[model samples]
Target: MNLLKSLLIVVIGILPFVVNAQSNNYKVRKCFGYQRDSCTTSANIFYKLNEDSRSALFVKGQSSQTIVSIYNGRDYRISLCWDHILGNRMGFKILDRETKNVLYDNSTDEFATDFEFTVTQSRDIIVELSIPGESTLSKSEGNEELIIIRKDKEMGCVGVLIEHMITPTKGF
Candidate 1:
């Protein structure tokens, strides 16, 4: 009976690991859609990332992107680039939303993932990206593009391309 009891305990411990391992089957990746002239293109990169993963801003020569947004149909994080910082410091202000809290703030431009915060649900958050002396705001009451994401192995995003504008003063 003692041997049987030990066997059951071992199985219980292994069960959790096994279950957690199953979650790895779903491949997590990021899709970046940028405009090439008047037409847009999408660049998909596959990796194992969680909802808490930092949104990819600039991957080497991809500095064309000014903002990085991520949402797993629920939790989300918004990141801005270094060029958007004003007065030598990036601005990250938490909006009055129904959920979410500020977690990381690299507004000083000392880190890669700048202005990282969590959200219980994805909502329109006011983000002001600009340079030291320039003022560039993406806020609008018109037609704004929405980004939606999901886990892999089940067909994730459907035409999720990002958009950006060229700030004359904001340099790479």
Candidate 2:
């Protein structure tokens, strides 16, 4: 009986950690492919969705990059979407992977969330995305309790939608 009681106590002690881990996994699963359908709908008729289109959990003030191949003779549209908690004006840029040149920067276009352009030459490009705001756990905040609460509330989903279609040939 004493052994059983000890086992029960141990299980009770470990329950919270198990539950917390499950909840974290659930949050990530909920964000996965979040914008796949909604973002692609805008390009459905003219463009086919590229496999590289994806969504991920993001926190304010975080930045990430993904590389994608752009084929020559194709027109592509790139769109960005996020949970409103992350706010608007998220930064988006396209850089040439080999030359590292900034091919395009949304900042100059009033932080446009979507861009469409034709690829003249096949190449790999880096798409960089940045969420707006200061880090959620900034040391300046100092309040541990507030930091914990803010971290949960500030996390959100960010999606990049890439669509492509053959560049239409000029008039015959």
What overall lDDT, based on C-alpha atoms, would model 2 receive against the true structure? Answer: 0.82
Cα-based lDDT for every prediction? 0.33, 0.82
TM-score of candidate 2 against the unseen true structure: 0.75
Residues 1-172, model 1: lDDT tens digits: 9999999999998998886454244354432321111122212232222322222222111112122344423323233333221123333443323343443334545633333233444454433322232211222223555623222222211121233222124367
TM-score, every prediction: 0.25, 0.75
lDDT of 2 by residue, 129-169 (tens): 98888664533446546554364567777889888999999
In model 2, which regions exceed 4 Å deviation? 1-28, 137-151
